[model samples]
Target: MTTTNAAEATTATAAARATGASAATDVLIVGAGPTGLTLACTLARAGAAVRIIDKSREFHRASRGKGLNQRSREFFHDLGVEAEAAASGIEHITLRKYRDGVAIADTVTFADRTPTPGMPYASGLIMPQWRTEEILRDKLAEYGVAPEPGCELAGFTQSADGVVATLADGRRIEAAYLVGCDGGHSPVRKALGVGFEGSTDAEECMVVGDVRVDGLDPAYWHQWFDEDAAVLLCPFRGSAHWQLQGIPERDADGRPAAPTLESFQRLVDRCSRDAGIRLSDPTWFSIYRINVRMADRFRVGRVFLAGDAAHVHSIAGGLGMNTGIQDAFNLGWKLAHVVLGRAAPGLLDTYEEERLPVAAWTLNLTDERLRAVVEGVKEAGVGTEAVITDDVTTLGVGYGWSSLAWGGAKAGGRAPDAPCRNGRLFDVFAGPHFTLLGFGRGSAAALAEAGEKCAGLLRTHLIEDGDDPGGHARRAYGVEGDGLVLVRPDNHIALSAGADRGAEVVDRLLRLGR
Candidate 1:
């Protein structure tokens, strides 16, 4: 909650210099949302000097992004905030269909699945976006880096070596790299002249907000659908409120109407047909026009973009915030490597090379899913969770096509979580270093040599065939025999190979890091 006013910012700048804080920080992150906060925490954890700022004067209060997909859950686990997130959230809720205020069929969004030894978080969680941000900000505070509120990025110019950023309050700061985690109307992207090419759906719009309602059961996500309009109320976990989404009739100009409490009440009355469900004590509201867009490029010189600044899409799959979280996670470690001098600048290019396509794919996938849901509602009088597909979990996301991927079938994919020794594979890969999972006795010598060669930059773990009685690690990683899987700081496999070539794969990967 540090305030960055004109005088305070100037005094702080002077104090930083007096205390021998670098004239140029390693990273300057704009926007204190999930993407920027996640990146700040990652870089700070990796011992990089980072400064994160937000245009707003206070932390956001709205539960704008609520769903945390399975991939994000795993990523948060690595960041050491999974338990808090899970505790503060609900795992899943059934969507109960209602017509004219009468309940009908109930559909569960996520199928029931038990946690396997390899996959700990088999399903997504539902928590308010404000809670998620709170968790991330708390973790960032632990690193002694609180986001500077009321500090806006006015303008910035970058050179071959560093970035010089000017704040709106007339303070200037220098940084080795700059990142924009700002929203879709990103000033940074506009300043960089990057093309955010896509279309905004003018025909369809949603009124979304959080409100307290009476006479509605809180156990299920209640939905009321008629021919032309629909209303959905999903109870927010750990709160007395529910998130409300509805489609209202357009104005005379055939435009999506603005959101207001009165309008919301009217829509509810129309959809519920006098069901007696009353919405009150509104806290937040917004009229969202679906925008499917992606930045043509993710980086320009020493400056880069992540989150909504880089891409935006429909909320059908609840991928907006989750994708942003993943973007920050992917960029965090690579930026740390370059900042800490453990990797070449070329490593940074892989950020866009790996993530840009994912964003593009998400845009199309969500667009189609949104269309499908709309069509289903029009055809069947109810929309199912069929749009919440396997891809929504994001576990299948990979970088197999990237140049960094090498060796075996699992290369460039997420390193699966599995039982190892007394703990798990993720426990071994929890830190800021690369991990080499050596399986079976034949790989012992190669693992030892690779570990010695990579020393501080890599951690090698030998998972003997009998380490876990169920052989979950081997099965999870698809290691049928003696093998080695080299995992990057981001927990994606960089190299996977047979025991004989484990050391060679490690050497080659390290050379790329150099």
Candidate 2:
């Protein structure tokens, strides 16, 4: 809701004045959206110098990306913003469906879900994208980093040493690596000559925005559907506005009419057929045409693409922003490690390898869900229920096929959470460091050795049967007797092995540049 002030901008500018226009930073992030901000926070927390910039003159307030899935919550948990996010978001709001002013079915959003020891956060939360970015920006500020506004990336050239990016204002910035989180039409991806391959649905379009709504119950996501037009109004938490999505009238050229507050009210009136329910004070709006696409490659030498720069998909699954955030999460630790000299440069390769498949599958899944939703709308009046699948939650996204996944059956997958004597496994893995969990007393020596070897880079915790009363840790990890699970900084399982193989895993980490 707030942009970086003069002092923060001056601070960022002063920090960048050292190398070229800015060589003091290790990474230069282009774009201040959820993806770029998440990456900036991740890198900054790891003490990797970063300078984030956005071409926009000021932060745009919008209800663009309103859903943060469970996996993304975990990412925020690592970034130290989950508490604020939880306080600012709402969950388990019911969907009240209607047809031509007649009330229809009432469906709970995330019904039949409960948090377990293995996965504490069971459902996603609904918060506007701007609020999410604000939380990230606030966190980034704690590290003395702020996103420079109205800064555009004109072009860039990379070499073996680093990347030199020329801004639109003719200022050059030198960084060890550059990332593009600029969105679907990213100039960074264009500069890299990467191909964005996908199709756009011209026929399917909706007007989406934030609006102050009255005479509607805020407890439910109100939806109204008829034969042609449809409208959905979901209340945003900690605010008086609601996220409005409705079918607008098309012009002779077949384009949806301009997204004005008046136009939105007309659409709502036409669909809901209720004059008492009103819309006003539209803060931000967009004519969302369903776009499904992904970049051919995620990285080119020292330059990389993330978020919408790397992929875009239908809003069916509400995975668009979450995917980008996860892309940044997947790339964040690897970039930090490489930039901070904690890992080999080769570690960055797994970013694309692990996320490319996820994007491809996400595209297919969202497309299918979109089609199903369309069909559901044609049959009944509700369709969003079609998008609420386990895959949409993104908890199942993993990289088991990645080379970094070494020994355990669940290697390269998301490390599960469990209760421990001190707190929880997640409590130990909260910060910007790798986590090595030693289950059983036999692994204590290996824990000590890893502690000394890895030092600040790795956090080791011993989990014995008595330490976890419910045995959730043992079951979640499939640890039989005495074993070790090495979790990457991104919370992905790097490897898992028996107690005797702990030294082997440690040796592998050393070979992989630690």
Candidate 3:
């Protein structure tokens, strides 16, 4: 940890008020990984002061989770960070399932949606975790914030008024809310005495990293499900670089019997004898111990947990970071509202109710993915809906149970995207403002009514450009005509309606966040 100063002393004072310790911060985030960083950026963009601390002194160079789902892309786009990530060697892949080197099943591809919103990233993206972090860091910098590195959360105490955290140096920083975006083994979780009761899987999956190999292929994320051993390989930037993992019977070379280039190579040779391809080189390797577990609760008074601190799951779907990022996304604004006194404390509680169920659902599905591979379902025999729900980036994931959820429209089930007169493809759910979608002139007066009451508190958009937009926005979100929609600050559809229904839709929206 670094030396503390007077500025550090006051950082936690903005989060309402705290008991015991008086340090205040609007949001005190523990952990500067993707989730924590995303939370910081989201809140800061909305003008909330934030402080994020990470135990790591610097960005981790090793690559993890080589695939980024579609839902994540939408969130990143809203943050205005996805553009750089999309350009930074992120490959657009046609997801495929292969068993013993034979293509068996293909995932729901993003190809059918012509000219999707958040284009270039309309589908899944293949980019390394480090690169993703780089983009996030850059975005954070734009907000005049930097992550506090090498400073760990030593201990903390929370109360209804606020959370007071005791630093390793014995200083107290207070914030109205404290979030543990920490990992599965969170210090904050330990301090809170939260119960993480889920059990671990029997399997031990090993992974190896960042090794440059001449013989590896660059086009796809490949998996080999041998009844005895399974291999997962992801290519890096069309280069010889790859991340490989294997389940080993023993720790040869004294390395953890997890994934490594060596083990992957050996497994590749074995699978080749069965399926006929050769793998070479000795690079990075490590083993993963799978645990599909989640905390019994996400919030306890002023203290909250997000990301892996809330749930831990298999690496099967590469969902760990994405899930946490979404966790941060869900909670960031509610905390801001609570702090700014724009909404009631009850709104913050919805964060747990909404995100916890999604986490549990994701953990279960990912666990099944691991089971499918381990049980030798063979990528060919795999019928898993890796992303059946669509909006893999998690942007489409909704909060069906919210006080602000005024009513349901025909597009109630999925995430909505639309063409706008503003020459932009608007995702009805990207946070940072109160969004008003205008289908026609009839809804304009009603929208103005809602906007006038909110003052500088709401941002309104009218979705009235009748042009086809070449079916770009229509196919991406399946909305073909002008329709009014209201998006909340947390990126969820508040209300949707056609021209005739605009007044009714605006009336229901005016009823929200009051």
Which stretches in model 3 have alpha-carbon errors above 4 Å?
1-24, 94-121, 238-240, 249-265, 273-285, 375-396, 410-415, 427-431, 465-484, 497-514
Per-candidate TM-score against the hidden true structure: 0.94, 0.94, 0.82
What ranges in model 1 sit over 4 Å off? 1-21
> lDDT tens string, model 3, 1-514?
2211121112234332443443446888998888898899988887777888887887786677665677777678778877776776554454455565666655554555544443435566777777788788889999899988877677776544456777776677776677888888888776677799888755454655556545434565565555565555666674566666555647556444545455566776675444544455544455567877889889877778998899999876668988988888888887776565555566666787788889988888777766764454643355333443343455456767655566655232334555555556444345566676555456677677667776544766654446435555445444445556666665676666564664565455344334
TM-score, predicted candidate 1 vs. hidden true structure: 0.94
Q: TM-score of predicted model 2?
A: 0.94
Q: How do the residues 154-196 of candidate 2 rate in per-residue lDDT, one tens digit apiece?
A: 8887666567788889998877778999999998888778899
After superposition, the stretches of candidate 2 with alpha carbons farther than 4 Å from their true spots are 1-22
Tens-digit lDDT track of model 1 for 1-514: 1111121012222335567775568889999999999999899999888999998998877889988999999889989999999998877668888876677788876667668777788779888899999999999999999999999988987755567889999898887788999999998888888899999877778889999999888888888877877888888777988889998657899887778888888998888887888989899999888888899999887778999999999998899999999999999988887777667777787899999999999998898888888787788765647577888999899999988897688889988888868888888898788888888988899888888787768888888867856888887788877888889888899887888996586567577544
> What is the lDDT of every predicted structure here?
0.84, 0.84, 0.66
Superposed by TM-score, candidate 1 places the C-alpha of residue 200 at a distance from the truth, in angstroms, of 1.0
Residue-pair clashes per candidate: 0, 1, 34
In candidate 3, residue 379 scores what lDDT?
A: 35
Q: Which ten contiguous residues of candidate 1 have the minimum total lDDT? A: 1-10
lDDT of 2 at 124: 90
Tell how far residue 181 is off in model 1, in angstroms. Answer: 0.4
